[model samples]
Target: MYSISFLIGFSLLAGFAVAASPDVETRSRRVRLSASVIALASVLLALFHLASGPEFFALSPGVLHVLDWMFTIGGVGLALVLLYFCRRIVAREWYIPVLVVLQTGLMLSAEFAEVTPEVAHPFYIDSFTVLMTLIVGVVGGLICIHAIRYMQDYHAHEKTVPNRQAAFYFMLFLFLASMFGIVFSNHLLWLFFFWEVTTLCSFWLIAYSGTDEAVRNGFRALGLNLIGGVSFAAAIAWLTFGPGLHTWELDQLIAAGSAMALIPAVLIAVAGLAKSAQLPFSSWLLGAMVAPTPVSALLHSSTMVKAGVFLLVKLSPVFYDTYAGLLLSLIGGVTFLVTSLVAVNQRNAKLVLAYSTIANLGLIVMCAGVGTAGAMWAAILLILFHAVAKALMFLAVGTTEHLIGSRDIEDMEGLVYRRPAMAAMMLVGILGMFLAPFGMLLSKYTSFQAFLSMDVMLGDGLMLATILAFGSAPTLFFWSKWMGKLVAMPRRLPPGTDPIPRDEAIALVSLTLITYVACALFPLADKVFVIPYTDYLGALGLIPVVAASIPWDNIAIMSLMLAGLFLMPLAFWLRPPRHAEVSGYLSGANVSGSASYRGAMGVERVVESRGYYLSGFIREDIMMRYGMLGAGVLIVVMVGGVAL
Candidate 1:
């Protein structure tokens, strides 16, 4: 049943500040409590839906219909509230409350209405819907909790007036609700509306800092996503007017995936790539790092990027066997390989994560494009596992930045002593990202098998598959180096730093728990969620045979990981002589009373060692131009191939 009351509760939580005193402490406590309660209720709602099955629903025509209207009207109202907030209409402080009231009324109408499914079914639940609802409610809610403490520290440090905390939290909740609407909607038009809402939400969140760079990045993000929106709109129009593709329901569109389905399918795939931030479009995501940590976590982990992949998976049946499918796979593979290479050159921790996110997404997209049951299963599992690990890493990096005032991995060397808990948690998160037995690696392994099998059977080109395997090797190299640097031993702590914040510690611990639980549950999860999706794909003729002996056994891989894990501790215990280290080939006489040395002229100079950004080899400007050109070409190939 659609619980209007639950939506009301979240809306009320967002508006709690209006009724409370202006004191900071009271507002903080109220926000935290309200966020916690809303999260708990969301979890309960998710559980209820999962247990009750998708068919349990009220057939009311009154409240439920009203809720449907409210959803539409409230969307506009929220936009207005945001406009007012941004424009500084002090007289219209009431807009947020009015928006909440309208949304509540919409929920009430939807809940009480006994409308036919054909006319309007605002409240409904299925497995897929429930999954997304859980994510929005749980992950999004926790981020809200994090923001409460994070904003306090952020403002205190920035010393800004006209604190934007209230508006920020308000939009955060709206973002969550819009994400829920996106996945839950049966109608394509409604989903598109929600899709735009998410884009708007991202725009606001990215520019929340109100800095010039923040605003620039936000505009960049907006510009790129608008491309996705246009593609989405085109796809919808094609589906609506094209032969035998009239319905907007996902099930209907999938059911109609005949030989003629390729045209719209290609359009949809284009939109997916844009939204997912695949190679050419990835600059926006990199730019998005200018926003707050919570925004980054939400974008990377739970919402925007995932929507793109979700759409691809949902429409796999339509494009799998056609040239469109092959093209999609190729695009995904290229993005995956190139971005992983680009990630190698990044010193900024968040940029590394951002590129890595794009790279992993490319892998997932390629898997979906492979159009096999095994590949689809791999993609979904990757999505779930990557979300937890990536979110953990982002939050960890955010905490580190707050503590050390830097996100550069070079500067973060020997950070463990200063914030051991965060460092340890980050290690786990990174391990989940790279090493085997973890879900991301497991998915990658499965993907490799899927690609290999696809190539052998279908006679598809193996270029992409080979590139993917080759590209992935560097992933382990860079991640291991960075993780090692994080916990690298030093003689003593660096001077001038305070202890870590309690809220940050709590956030890290919670993220770790989630990541570990998700990893631990992978085996069981494979049985429940993955097996079914895989079986569905298998039935569609995409199953791949996984070879047992290729590179090494599980034990061999595990041993390597164990070795890396123990090496740091061993190094610390041994405390090898620091003076034993020799200079590089260009070494000169020591100078400046430190690591400095005399050059050719006997001049004192510092010996600087820096990691590669490889800008010359893969310059962003060059890459961006080429990436967009490639994406555009692919778009043409896909659409034309489908039309033909």
Candidate 2:
């Protein structure tokens, strides 16, 4: 029967296939098809888990044995190679459906056949694991498809650079496979192996352009992540030798409580902080923007950084109400507040996105540090909404950059008139990040309630609330500025064809619908996914589950507003609503109509306004220096508190 092993193995094997392909066209077709299949498999896996009980396929004794046999002895080697042969059009067309049908049959059989009693092993599967798999498979797949068209344009623009599309796709698929491994592995050693694989993949993809700056940034990323790797290794060593625990299973270690696990947990938390690009470790992600847009989307949203938070949230229970928890939460709080302010100073489109990504990650880290069931619930919601929304924003910006020939926020001032479809999609992405009646906003509201309910001894709830309130202001400022630029109208539309390629358009539209659907169905999501997971934690005595319920009344209101948000836009676009056009009114007489005004010396002056970035006061370099300093201190205190 199909299992998580197949999901991991197929993705790993697909990376090898894509890398070994003879040409660019073959590589593209194989990657797109492979990603689609992986996504389908992920959805089926999640559904099967839901249909069966929570304990369904929780663990089995001989799971790895099956994986070993499938990958060896020339059993499926020949068929795997034939699957990617682009010249055989008929074979390619037939192979996909056949594969899908077989997988579906296998999954159905496994579901109906008697499930064995649950057992413990290196691998673990649960609702959370499947939820993450869905995010990676679905979001990661769309990003891959979008990259197909974006890379072609990228190569055209960077004519002097050597083509390395095959290597790029190889790294992309390998990254996906590594993510599956990270989420599924319960053995700390096994998890470490996958964690390092993602780090290596990240370095390779970031340096694909082979430029001096790209190489430099890639090395910087490698060095910092290696520090994280070393920390993970040290934690494993401590768990095995220091505490005298022979087993490396994470659940067993957490069940040992804070007294036995605090030191190793703090070490692992340091690794998570670095991997997620928290304040002191954030330079690597910012520099990663030198890579293509897909790389940024993949790293920032679904795959790499998400792996970091997944680990941290898993380890949250161990640190609850300890001094370590207070210090760690402070690290995240400081990172969030500082980065949001720094983002306001950035004019480069990607830089702004990168800073915002780090800031939101900081918020997730803060929730994890709180270590209550309710806080973890808020953390997971933030991850889900942020992944979909951020992916949409990054991909939309990439398409807009290609059309306008610049990534500066000022250059996109009249995008709505020039490319209405792209602008509308971009607007949707922007709204998802900060506005009411959207998942991100609602997630933040949940986090606020979770914070209020916390009963931690060492942590000050009011202080955390203050940081959140102050930090959110700058988030609104930066996103609103960019949103305004996208919608601002010019006197006349520019004379050019801002055509979105089919692949890019499909990804953008799909993500937009996903963002809306997720917001619309959030109350149901909370019941189905969040509540159950938290209840399980409470039952295990891992966290204190307080009295929490989804705010149904607020959800109903948001639904009504959401309906208007989408329906009004569709109505305006569908119907012909004619309006009278008017010229701009200047205080003085209009010299050349709305374009120019008369000055004191009878000189013609152009009318214009610009965004207030506060670049002089809120400098990026200055803020980063101080932010890193503050976060570094907090991390030190967390480790010390735990050890002492």
Candidate 3:
């Protein structure tokens, strides 16, 4: 119980130590050691929570004492980070794993402590929370580890930008700490504070480069997330003054039921929509690509955006059969459709990733809005798979950009030959997002079923289902195109490069293993986390029970497909090609010795192939404008419905 207080203090104290340390080597060592420690603690805690039962930790004097010390220590850390940024003081770096440690201790203490009637209870430990902790610890720790060498290369490449690794690491840890706080806290005030902390951390990290675009994008992210912040604050105020029913506990708020919580729920859903980067508010996440890749990975995967969906999922009970729920489902469906299509027009790898991240988040948001057992089943799996796979991708692409000196898909042609390991890991990540037997695609299947069973009061089930079907086609198109680009044979010898750094390689490989392991063990995940959470909600009558089972025959096919996913790649790697290579026959006019052929005017020309990026038809700006307008209308109607 007191770990919450300790973590608050430790984060500030450790952040200060890392940010104010004079020696760079010392900082790097601290970051590595701290990150590793936190990751181990997170996994262990997840196991412990799974073995024991989920329980609430009550507030204690020790926690209050730690809060008092936090202000004193936190002020000093803030000053040091600011001073480091000003170039007046030398400092170092640390990563985000410490948050997991803090949360683990809180859960452990709660397991032993007895709840007293007099003490305030602010912590909620559950299987779902444990799952999120595992994600934050494993994924976030690897990201921090990857950043150690990445920032070195980043500063090497961007010589004009001043190195602020110290400030960067400080904010990074703070971000994770806030995430831990959000998932663990039951009280609305505590959740809001942590929520706002992530906003501040994201703004700082996104603007880290000091470039005009970076600064602009940073402010853009800040401005948009503040919308969510303000909405959250409004919801808190409404609950505080408007309804004198119960204390500001999330469970109590939900227990107030749909009619009483409708307005605040609508406000909070808007906040979720913005935070998850749905529709009009999505530009913030897209703009965030200007930041470093670790920041992108952190935000898109385990931390910032995840926090958004987490809140929405938490409020699913209130959303059931409500107009506000319809708003989320519709907006999410539209965002998924539009973003998936727009991704086809993207040439930059990170932009593709950004759009993909938004699209998947839209799917999760849609599922949460459905507020049924089957829907939540899909939502949680989507969260887990998306976190692991997307983080793997962002980190791999970050390394690739450094090696090839570009983040363009075209520039990555023949990457399988030039950077085989990176490309293979990336391929796994890409397929994991959309391919069968992978968690995301499987989760989508569950979501589709959830939609089919949608309540009549919500909206047209078929209409939403139709959007998903249309959206899925583009999802396949963009991912396959990018996959082809990565695995394509080079036209000529590519530029040479150094091997992937040890830290980056470890992070990439670890995530790659996690991707496969998670897919194979998904049934376990469903059993231990997803099913229990869904059952809890269903028992409370917060969500409806529906036909949620995947057919055994379909599972059999998927299991075989899963085998092929790894086996085909392994076979190709192990077996040598039996056929001889041949040069291209360009219009039946091939050069004997070269890849070129005689063309117009008898000039020798090289054959070239490029991706069909449907840019001409699918304009991003046009799509974004219309998508935002549509979602905006739904949001207005949702709010007005609550008010009336």
Please report the candidate that would top TM-score against the real structure: 3
Instruction: Return the TM-score for each candidate structure.
Output: 0.82, 0.87, 0.89
- Candidates in order have lDDT scores of 0.68, 0.77, 0.78
User: Can you write out model 2's per-residue Cα lDDT over 566-644, one digit (the tens) per residue?
Assistant: 5543443345233223567786768655656787777777776678899888887888899899899888888877767
Model 1 lDDT on a 0 to 1 scale: 0.68
Runs in model 1 deviating more than 4 A are 3-21, 45-130, 160-162, 258-261, 455-461, 490-493, 533-609, 615-617
Worst 10 residues of 3 by lDDT: 88-97
- Deviation (Å) of 232 in candidate 2: 0.7
The TM-score that candidate 2 achieves is 0.87
Check candidate 3 and list the clashing pairs: none
What candidate 3 gets wrong by more than 4 Å, as runs, is 2-12, 61-119, 436-438, 570-581, 588-594
lDDT of 3 by residue, 537-605 (tens): 777777788767778898888788667865554443345223223775576467753457887778877
Cand. 3 TM to true fold: 0.89
lDDT tens digits, residue span 1-644, model 1 = 44534654454456545234377677667666666666676667665654443442344778655655665675566446544544432342334334334433433343334431243443345554555555666666667777777777778778853478767776777777677667666656567667877877787888888876787677667667766766676766666555665554665566566465667677777778878998667888989998888899889988889888888877776665557777788778777777787787789899899989998898888887776665776788888777777887888888788888888888777666555555677787887687535477667766777776664235564665686787797677678778867766532346455666665666667767776667666566655555544454345443333332335587457546654753443343335223223444447775443356788878777654455566687676665567667866876787787777
